[model samples]
Target: MLGAHDSTRDAGRAQRWAARLAWPLLGIVISLGLWALAARYISDVEVIRAAFAPQAGLKALVHLLGSGELWPHISTSLQRIAIALLLAMAIGVPLGLCLGLSPLFARISGPTFQFLRMVSPLSWMPLAVMALGVGEAPVVFLLSFATVWPIMLNTAAGVAALDPAWMRLAQSLSATRWETIARVVLPGCISHILTGFRLAVGIGWIVLVPAEMLGVSSGMGYFVLDTRDRLAYDELMAGIVVIGGLGFALDWLARTISSRWTQRGKQG
Candidate 1:
């Protein structure tokens, strides 16, 4: 009976894995089919041709792989993104914690935060350029600005969702305010905080490309502009593909890490 049950469970797991893999594979097949059909039927003047031409884009990707120039641009963009993400976490998490823990503070600052958050990050580009000058700083600032809200909001939500029983028990044990927070609040909220970080990284990555275009000479954004200037549509498309792949990879990595951490926390 046990052996048969084990076999059944294994078959179920295998089926699930197959199903998960099939969807993405099917999506890719469908996308490629659509691309081929569009390429065949669409007018040459359409952007779709330049965007999806495999031969041209593949060649451009190969050229980029061979050249040292591509690496530098990728590195610079990644560096700026990393810095901005770190800065956003540093600022957002503490503010979020405070707002979550103290009702008075939340009420005082909520309106101001909402107002700032509602304003589009792009709208600040001109001001960022004027105030910070045309450089990586402005780009990083804009990326960080775009990212901060998600982390902040998530952190606050995490804190708010903490079990009140834990706090009550800690107080009953005569725990000091700091001791209770350190022992109870942080650990309870950590999973949510990590979720926030994953979200923030995604937002930062999305903003980084456009923010890099704000006048930085090096980075994927500049590469895109350069490709356009030279009428290298294939290279432009290739750069865009690279950006998207990298962003997806980054988000996947972060989520994997977060899941592992959550699992560990549960086990402990």
Candidate 2:
């Protein structure tokens, strides 16, 4: 009986994986077909043959990868995102905690925060460049600014929603303020923080592509521009694919981390 049950479970798992894989493959095929159809209408024979064909894009991807020309751009973009995310967390968490803990502060600053958050990150690029001078500094600033709102708002909401009973219990235990915040508050709010971080990462990454196009050199965004200027549409498409792949991987990592954290929280 046990062996039969194990076999059934294994089969189910295999089926689920197959289904997951199949849908994406189906989508890719449909997309390629559409591209091919569109390519037929293009006036430029070379552009149609090279840029719009899936095989051409794949070849370009392979060539770029084999040549290792995309590595520096990838690394630079990754580093910028890492630094910007860390900066957002450092600034956002404390602000969120404060807003969460204090009703007066929340009321006072909430409108202002919402207003600032509504402004597009791109609008600030010119100002950032003027103030910071053209380099990674402005990119970091724009990304950090763009990403901070989600983290801050999520953190604040989590803190605000924490159980009053938890606070009472900590008070009864005579926990120090710092002790309560470190042990009780932070742990209780971690799931929310992680949720915020996930959102911040996604937002930051999307913004990072454009942010990289700023005065700084060597990033996926810069590569895209370079390819465009050089009229390498196939290579440009390849870069887009690389960006999408990296973004997907980052989101998957975040989801995995969030899931594990939730499971651990439940277990504890």
Each candidate structure's TM-score, on Cα atoms with residue i matched to residue i, is 0.88, 0.93
Summed backbone clashes in each candidate are: 0, 0
Clashing pairs for model 1 are: none
Q: Give the alpha carbon lDDT tens digit for every residue of 1-268 in model 1.
A: 9999999999999999999999999987897677567665666676657555766776888889798658898899889988988998899988888999999999999999999999989889999999999887899899999989988988899889999999899989999988987888888988888898899888888878778888889999899988888877788878987898889999999899999999999899
- lDDT, candidates in the order shown: 0.87, 0.90
Show model 2 residue runs off by greater than 4 Å. 1-12, 42-49
lDDT of 2: 0.90
RMSD to true structure for each model, in Å: 3.1, 1.9
